[model samples]
Target chain A: MSTPTETETPSETETEGGTRLSYETRDRLYHLALYGSAALFSAVILFPIYWMVQNAFTDSQTVITEFSWLPSPETVTLDNFSVLAAGAVPRYVINTIVVTAGTIVVVVGVSLVAGYGMARFRFRYKESFAQFLLLGYMFSPIVLGLPLYLIWSEIGLLNAQIGLVIALSSISMPFAVWLMWKYIQTIPESMEESAWIAGASRWRTFWDVVVPQTKPAIVACALFAFAIAWNDFTFAQILLPSQESTTFAPGIMRLIDQGGYTSWGDIMAVSLLMTVPPLLFAYFLQEYLLKGFEVRTR
Target chain B: MTVHIDNMTRVFDSPNADRIVAVDELSLTIEDGEFLTLVGPSGCGKTTTLRCVAGLDTPTAGTIRVDDRDVTELPPQQRDVALLFQDIALYPHMSVRKNMEYGLKIAGVPEDERREHVAEAAALLQIGDQLDKMPASLSGGQQQRVALGRSLVRDPSVFLFDEPMSDLDAKLKRELRPVVQRITDEIGCPVLYVTHDQEEAMTMSDRIAIMDDGELQQAGSPKEVYSEPINDFVGEFIGQPAMEFFDAHVESANGTAAVSMGDHTVSLPATADELEGYVDSPVRVGVRPQQIGIGDPAEGIEAEHVLDEPLGDETHSIFETEFGDVTVVTHADFDGDGDTEYGLVLDESATQLFDPDSGVRIH
Candidate 1:
C-alpha cells in the first residue's frame, strides 16, 4: 500500500512540469537503500564482539598472527582461557561479582523508596534536598580519594568487600533515585486514590498499586547502577591496599606490574571475564533499558 | 438515613475573612425517595448544598435530614449517601469489576457479596462485557457508566450528583442523563442532583430550583418556575434569550388599568377588580419570546426590528423601541435589511408584572 496522494518526483514532473525521474522507481529505490544501509551499519557495529570471541578461541601464536581484517579458522584456540585460570583472574572475578551483586541489591532497595518519597511527597525544601543529594556525584573520585581512604581507615573499612559495597551504592544512589523519580511520576494519581478509597493505607497503595507499575524502570535502574559500580576503577584503586582484597580493575593493574613482559593472553581472558556479567545483566534487562531510554525523549 | 444541619454554614475563612459563600443559609428537605435537584448559575450554592448533604462539607448554618434523622454531624460513610463528582473519579488501574467492588470492599462486605454486587452493577450498566477491562481501556462514556456502577454497588439510601454529566460530550450527556434519570426514579432513593446548566436541570429534574447570589430564587416544577417567576432575577435567568423586562406605567380608567411601555400598551383587564386602586405605579413587566408572536402589522402593538439573530429553526428579531430592547423570533423575514421597523403584540394575559425597585411579583 502506498500514500499515492503525496506528490512524488516523477508524478510531480509528469503532471506538473518537472524534470525528475519517475516517482515510483525512486520511491522503491529509496526504501530499498534505507533497509540495506541499516542492516550493513548494525552488522558493522556488532563486528567487534564477533572478532573478540573468534580471537579468544584461537591458539596463542596463531590467534595473534591471524588477528587479520576478517574471521579465520586456523588462528583460534582455548589457550587464552587456560592461561587465566593459573593467575588471580578467578578470585578477581569472584570479588567483582560480590561487589556488583551487593551494590545492586542495596541501591535498588533503598533508592526506590527514597525516590518515591522525594517525588510524591511534598515537604519543606524537598527539591533542594534532592539536588543536594545529587551533589555527591559532582566531585571527582580522584579528589575524594584521600578523604575516602582516611574515612575508611579510621573506621577500619579499607580493603574490605563491605567498604566496596558501601562506596559503590553511595555513588550509584543519585542516579537510581533520579531515574525512579521520573518513572514513578508517570503512574496515574487515580491508582493511589482508588487504593486509598478502597480502605488501603498509603503504604499498602505504594507496594500493591504504585510499585508494580514501576518494575520496568526499577529493573533498568538496577542494571545501570550495577554496570556503573562494577566497571568503576577509581574507588577500587583508592580503597584496596592489598592484592588479596583487590577487585578486577586493581587486580588486573597489579598483575601487569613493573615488568617488561605483560601477560597479553591472561589479560585478554580476564578482560573478557570482567565484561560478561554486565553483558548478561543488560541482556536480561534489555526491554526495560530500551523503554527507560525511549521515555527520555517522549 | 437521616441528615440534619443546624446553623450549618461553611465559611472557608473567618467572619471577616475573604471567602466565597458556596452554600448561603441554604435549607431544604429530601423526603425519603424524593429526588431534588439544586440548579443554579456557577458560584451559586447548588454544589455546596449537595456536598453538605453528602457530609463532604459542614454547612455554616442550617440543618439537613433524611427520614428525619440528623446526619449533619456524620461523616460521609456514616451519612449513607453516594456522591458522584462531575470528574468521574474512577480507578484507572483497576478493572471494571474491581472498580465496582472497591467501595464494597472498603465497607467490609464479604467476598461473595462483593462479587454479587459488582456483577449486578456490571449487568445494570451493561458493562458486563467490560468487567475485566481496565478503566483506561474503556471509552469516556463507558468510564462514566463504570463510575455510576461504582456508586450503584455502594447501595446508599441517597445519591448526590455534582454535575455528574457535565464532563461528558453532548451526545454522551444526552445518552447518560436519561439513564441517570431512570435509575434515580427506579431506585426511588432521594437524590440531590447539582448542575449549573439550566437545560440539564430541566430535562433531568421533576422539580428545578433556580439559584443566584448564594440564594434560591425559586423552587418548583419547570413549568411553574418558567411561567411564574418570583422575581426579576428568576425571570431573567429561566428562559432562552431570557424573559424580556422593560419599564412600564399603570394608569386607571373606567375601573380598568392599562400598562403603557413606549408606543406599546397591554391591558390589565384580567386583573381590573384585583388592581383597582393601583395607578401610576412604576413596574417592570416581563414577556416571553415564545409568547409574543407575529401579530397583524397594522393592529398589534408596534415594535421595530433592530437586528435578527438567525437560529437554525427560527430567526429572532431584536427591536430597539420606545419601551426598551425587545427580542422576538420570527419564522419569516419581513425585510432583507438588518434593521427595519416591525410590529409585535404582547400576550397581556401571559405578561408578568413586578415592582421595579424591590423586584417582587406584584398582583
Candidate 2:
C-alpha cells in the first residue's frame, strides 16, 4: 500500500498541484471555522467564572462603583480575601469539607456493596428494587427535605454536621447506586469466579478484584457525591441552620441576609472560595471520569 | 483427585418464559488424573455442568464430591478447584506474575514461596520473560497462557476449563491444544473441560461426554462414542460435515436383511441383527462421510455430483442423492465435475442404524 503511494507521489504532484492548493486552502478554512466555533463555545461557558474571579480580586468599593468588563490589575486588592480569611469563612470551609468527605465515604462504600449485590446476585424483586432506587433519584430533593428535617430534629441530629452529611448522602445514594450498578454490569462475572476459585472469599473477591476493576466508576461516583454535598443549600439551610453548624452554602446565604448592604467583594470571594474544591476535584478526576463511561473488562 | 457428580440438575426460572432446565439429572465420575471433556451444542448444559463442578454454580439437587469429600455446600474457594474461563479473565491491572500469584497469596502462602511457584509455572508455560508485563499488553495466546498459569500455580485438586481456547484463531487454537494437554497431564489432576468443538474433544479428552437439551447423551472413549454412539444425536454431532441420514425401510428374507432407500438397497451386516425386529418398518440409516467411497460409476449407489471441496489432504465431494445431500471424503487426487453421476459405496461394517421414532441406535 505504501509503495504504490510513494511511486505515485511525483507524477500526481506535478499534475494536481493547483487543484491540491485549492483543496488545502478549503481544508484550512474548514478547520478554522471548526476551531472558531469551539473557542466561542468555551469562552461562553468560562466567561462567568472569569468575571467571578475578577470580582474576587477587586476591592468592595471598585466592584460596587467601577464594574468593568475586563480585569484591571491596578485596582486588584487582597482586602476581600483578607476579610474572608478573618471571619467565619474558615469554619464554613471546614464544615463543607467534612460534610462532603463524609457524604463520599458513606455513598461510595454503601453504593459499591449494593451495586455489586444488584449486579451479581439473583434475588426476588431485584428489578423492582432497582426501579425503586431510580424512583428515589427522580424525586426532587425539596420534596424529601421537610420530612428529613423533621426526622433529624426528632432524632436530635439537627444542627449537626453529621446530620447534614446524612441528608446530602441520602440525596446522592440513589444516583450513585444507579451509576455503580450500570458500571459494574460491564465487568464480566467470570473475573469474580476466577478469583473465588483461586481461594478468595466473597468479601476478598469484591475488594481485591471488583474494586480495582471498577475504580474509575467509584472515583466518578465520589466526585459526584462530593459535588452534591458541597453545593446543597436547602438541606443545610433547613437541617443545620445554626451559625456554627451550617455549611458554606447556607453560611454564605446568612452572610448576605444579615446586613443592610450587600458586600459584593465578600460574596464574590466566598463564592470563589467555595468553587475551588469542586473545580480541583473535577480537574483531577477528568481522566477517570471519561474512562468511567468507557470501562471494559480485559 | 477423583471427582464424582451424582444426579445433578440446574434450572433457570424467569418471568418471561417457562423455567428452563439447563442441566437435567446428570451423573458421572472422573477418575483421578483423567482428562474428560463435556462436548455438546450451544444450550447443551455442558458449561453449566462444569460450573457446578467448579462450585461457581450450585446444582439444584445433587452431591458433588472430590476425593470422597462432599463439596456440594461449599463455596468455590473451599472446593479447592481451579476453573479457567473462555474469556481468559486475567486481572487487567495486575502483571502476569501478580495474576499467577493471586491465588497462592489468598491461601496465605509466604512471599518467597509464592514467587517460587509463580516462577516455576511461568517457566513451565514459557512465559517467564513476560511475567512483568500487564495482561492487556500481551497477545491473545499469551493472555490465555497467563490465565492457565494463574490456575496452575494454585495446584488445585481438580481443574475445570470452559471452552478456554474458543477465542483463539485456528492456528493459535491448534498450537495451544497440545500445550494445554501436556500441562494437564503434568499437573496430574482430574480435569473436566467443556467445549462445543467436537474435534477438540476428540483429540484432547481421555473420555468425552456428549450432552443435548440438558441431558447427558453418552460418556465413553472418543473412539467408542464416535463408532458406537448410543443415539442418533451423538452419531450426527460427533463428526465434521456430520453423519448423513437416509430414510430407509428394513426388509429381511431368508435370514438376509437389507435397508432399502429409493431404488437402492444396501445389505445390512451381521452385527445389525439387533435391528431385525424392525423388518418391513422404517428406520434411519447413518453413514459417516469418510465411510462413503466413490467407486466405478456403475457399481454402487448412484448420486449426482454437487461440488467438490478440496481441503489440502482430502476432498469432500458433496452429492445430491435420493436421500438428500450427502458428503463423501475422497482422495485429493480424485476429480469429479458437477452435474455428473457417481457411485457411492457405503462401508458395510461402518453403517449405523437408528430407530426412526426415538432416534436410538439399534446396533
Give the Cα error of residue B178 in candidate 1, in Å. 3.5
**DockQ for all candidate structures vs. native:** 0.14, 0.69
lDDT of 2 by residue, B1-363 (tens): 799999998998888999999999999999999999999999999998998888888899888999879998888888888888999999887888999999999999999999999999999899999999988889999999999998889888998999999999999999899989888988899999999999999999999999999999999999999999999999999988799888888876334468787677888764345666787899898999999999755766788888889998999988887778889998998788775668888887788889999999985
Q: List fnat, each candidate.
A: 0.13, 0.93
Misplaced by over 4 Å in model 2 are A1-44, A137-139, A291-298, B253-256, B271-275
Residue B89 Cα positional deviation in candidate 1, in Å, after optimal superposition: 3.7
Model 1, runs deviating above 4 Å = A1-55, A58-67, A78-123, A126-137, A141-195, A207-209, A212-298, B5-31, B42-81, B107-110, B185-190, B206-263, B267-286, B296-340, B353-363
Cα DockQ of the candidate 1 complex: 0.14
The prediction achieving the highest DockQ against the true structure is 2
Backbone clashes for every candidate come to 28, 0
Model 2 scores a C-alpha lDDT of 0.87
**Per-residue lDDT over A1-298 for candidate 2, one digit per residue giving the tens place of the 0 to 100 score:** 1343334444455597744544444557888999999999999999989988999999789898996898787888878887567678788888888888999999999899989999988899998988887677666777888898899999999998899888888788888998889888988889989999998989999999999888888897898898899899888889987788888898888788866988878888989988988888899898766775454643
